[model samples]
Target: MKEFASIDIGTSYTRVLMGRMGDDGVIQINGAGVSPSQGVRNGGVVNIEQTVQSIQTAAREAELMSGLVVEEAVVNITGKHLKGENSRGVVAVTNRDRVVTESDVLRVIEGAQNIRIPADQEILHVLSREFVVDDQSGIRDPIGMTGVRLESEVHIVTAGKTALTNLRKAVNAAGIRVTNLVMSSLASSEAVLTSGEKDLGVAVVDIGSGVTDIIVYVDGGVFSSATLPWGGSHVTQDLSFGLKIPMEAAELVKRNSGCVQIAAVDPIEKIELPAMSGRPPRWVLRQEIAAIMEPRMREIFELVDQELMRSGKKNALSGGVVITGGGSRVEGAASLAEEVFSMAVRKGNPLPLGGFFDRVDGPEFATSVGLLIGAAQSTDTARKAPRESGSGWMQKLRSWVSENL
Candidate 1:
């Protein structure tokens, strides 16, 4: 049995999950922990010390519950600083007379990795959506195929080197080795999206406290990703500004009364608006609460739509959008998304792991669950070593210079 620890350092909270994958293939979740986030603001780490403290808190809690000390963990990365781009590469099969081998696949992926990146960033993941050999499309694996020209289209995810370095520092300070850094949207997709749904085409939107992450998948892999600066915190800010209430009171109102699409409440729908100490409480109509929230929610959907169109994938999604995270739990968000995208939408909660996971199976836990699942799946063949075409990083540097200079 292989035991691994997973941690999700999210905008609003950080969570840790410890699990054991038995030899029989059953994954047992032994323990987990969540702590209020401090290091991240809108998906970027602004305060390293606070972030380290949060990670330490969660790690200690997980160790306590699981009775196992965790020294390494698969961590999640996200925020507006992340960028995804599509690139295509074509490689001539060197040994035309011999059957294509795994080396050929690696060569193609290496060819795809030839792209320009900024000085302060590095490519984190290169995921192939499909492969074509001699104009034959939709081939998942091209090995043993008899084609001279192999082509591949891959999605490359990049993150700022400074951001990653800081994250690593914080994790190290918390006394954990960073096994791998999985992007937040990809992790969320794994936790909430199923294989069939991805094959059919689906967009998973993780709307957390500070930032919203969108991941689109079609034909069985990630198609694209987008990060928006708005999320649940925006709603809280709106309530605070519109209701003339304190931030904390506004937060309470949003959680208690806010609805994304319903602006007008029935005459009977009334909620008590808490006031600051020494101030009189106010009786507010539910409609007033919705009135403040609907526009912001609508704006978020509009921005998502605009981003989809910008990526030239506006009409490509077929399974529609699946919304997750604490923000997704807000009432009327699914309806709002449907109205904006004219497609089916559903709220996503973490999948039931059939063990200790039942306690943390909510949208907030999606990234954490994804981290664990990623740690488990990291052992698969998908993670192959790069062919020694001069180290992958060196090749990336050369490619960047070729394009930028």
Candidate 2:
């Protein structure tokens, strides 16, 4: 069994999952480990030293448990600097009256690559949303069809160069090669989302400790992705400020008592908060606790809605919203999302990849699991001869190795 590892460097914690590919094409988890993430805030690495330490700790623990030499890893990245936009490209068929060939499709994609990206940023992904052939529309594939014009509408995702460089440096410092970088929300969606959901239109919200990342998919591609610099940490901060408690204690309480929907809280319910230095112990009502969280959660959901509308995908998401990540684990979150979006909402869990992963399956593990899947896909692609290389398979293989492998 060949083994691979995936690392998710989140705002609050860094996690690593080691997976072994089976003969049946199913990937199974062999080991998993996590450590508190430092030097990361709102999705960007602020301290390279602290980030490296966390990555090394998680990777080492995973390696020790699985006995696999972790050389290459898929790293997850996200932040406000990650931006996405929609673009269209058109290409005329070489034989205007003849059937559109695979080369024609490639040409259309190449045409779509024209975007005014900043010099400090790089293209992470160019996902085709839909294909249009001649005057006809909504074509999935144009090959073998006669068309004069081939057009492709795609979504482009780009990230800051400095942030990406810092992340790659941290992974390299851990003595591991970054196989590829994937957007955090995209990674989470890969873990929990079904093909049907994406085809039907859906939204994914990945809430970490210091940021709440949102992505919406319509017409089988990402329509929008944005980050709100507020997450579980904000709720903890609220508790610390409102109750005058320590940050740690506030976090514990928020986790134990936080409820996004008021109906989930009982008016008579009371919680005895831990005492702080020179402070008397306080008993807080559940409703009061909900009060602090409701506003913040409301604000986050509103921002997501605003983005959905801005992307013109608000009414198109019939598949509703799928929420994941550590913060999404809070009680009453699904109901709160339902209220805010007025649509079906569900808490998403990591995709079942088989084996011990079922035991540790949760929203927080979405990115790690998705990274493994993405790594496998990338590995498979690398093994194949790229079409752009040349006509002959042998020549294409040699070119791919020279350029990419």
Candidate 3:
């Protein structure tokens, strides 16, 4: 049995997912484990030992549940150091018939990677945005088309080498091998965004604990991505300060009764705070908690809006926004996002894929599930030889689904 696995090293938590790819191309969750994270801040490893221990604990629980060891797995990468930009590559068709072929497509994509980048960073992904054949534009796939000149436009995601090296050290120290490092937002998009949403235009906002990852899709391609340094942890801090409670108790209250919009929460509903530091337990209206959370969440969405506007694609998001991750689990996040962006919004959770979906169904597990999906497909594709058929780039595209995800 081929075991497909994924590890999401989140800020507040670490998740290890164990699954198997069935013959039907769907993933079956064999087991999943979650553990509180340490030595990680904003999805980047700071303390290698602490991160290693956390990965080990989560992998053990997942292995015990599935009876499959996670020797290697696709892991997620995130942090402020990740950046995405659009680039263009043009090349001449090398075929005798002048037909765009898989080789030509590959060369064109390779040409797109020539952009100048900082020496400390390297490209992680080169997602094709569109293609052009001769004078014709907006081609999704150029293979088999007769054109002397072929062009490719792509979104290149780059990550700081130091950040990646530390992440690898932590994961390697945990007694497992890292198969691939996928961007957090791209992985989530694999699980949440529908193809329709991608073509029509949409933005996925993954509001994690220490950071919020944003990715914009237009015309069925990624146009931009950005990471904000603030996330749900800020809200917890606010609750801790305003309610005069400990961080732990504030977190509990925030999860149990927190809502971002005051109107979404009942003013009459009261929260009984756990006594901390010998202070008596105090009762406060839920609205007060929402009041504190609202401004911060609003600020986050506003920042996301600013990012969208900066991308020059703000007017293109007709499909609106899909919010996910831990921060998004807070009540009224979508509502607040819609108000801030003046567009339709919805909470994004993992789509129904296969058996044991119930175990990893929430928005928070989107990255794990997505990584599993890509891993399963990778195994299947690796077993087959690239087709020499006239369909040209189609077979390569099938392989790309797994590799690029």
Q: What's the lDDT for candidate 3? A: 0.88
TM-scores of all candidate predictions against the true structure: 0.91, 0.92, 0.95
lDDT of 2 by residue, 102-149 (tens): 777667766787889999888776666777888989876666788788
Candidate 2: clashing pairs of residues: none
Task: Estimate candidate 1's alpha-carbon lDDT, on a 0 to 1 scale.
Answer: 0.82
Candidate 3's C-alpha runs over 4 A off are: 388-405
Q: lDDT (CA) for every model shown?
A: 0.82, 0.82, 0.88
**1-405 in candidate 3: lDDT tens per residue?**
688889999998999998987677778898888999999998899999999989999999999988889999989999999999999999999999999988899888888989999999988888888999999998987887998999999999999999999998999999888878889999998899889999999999999899899999999989999988888999999999998888999999999989999997776999788767767768999999999999999998999999999999989999999999988999888888989999999999999877678888999998888888777766655556666443324435544533643
TM-score of 2: 0.92
TM-score of 3: 0.95
Best by TM-score: 3
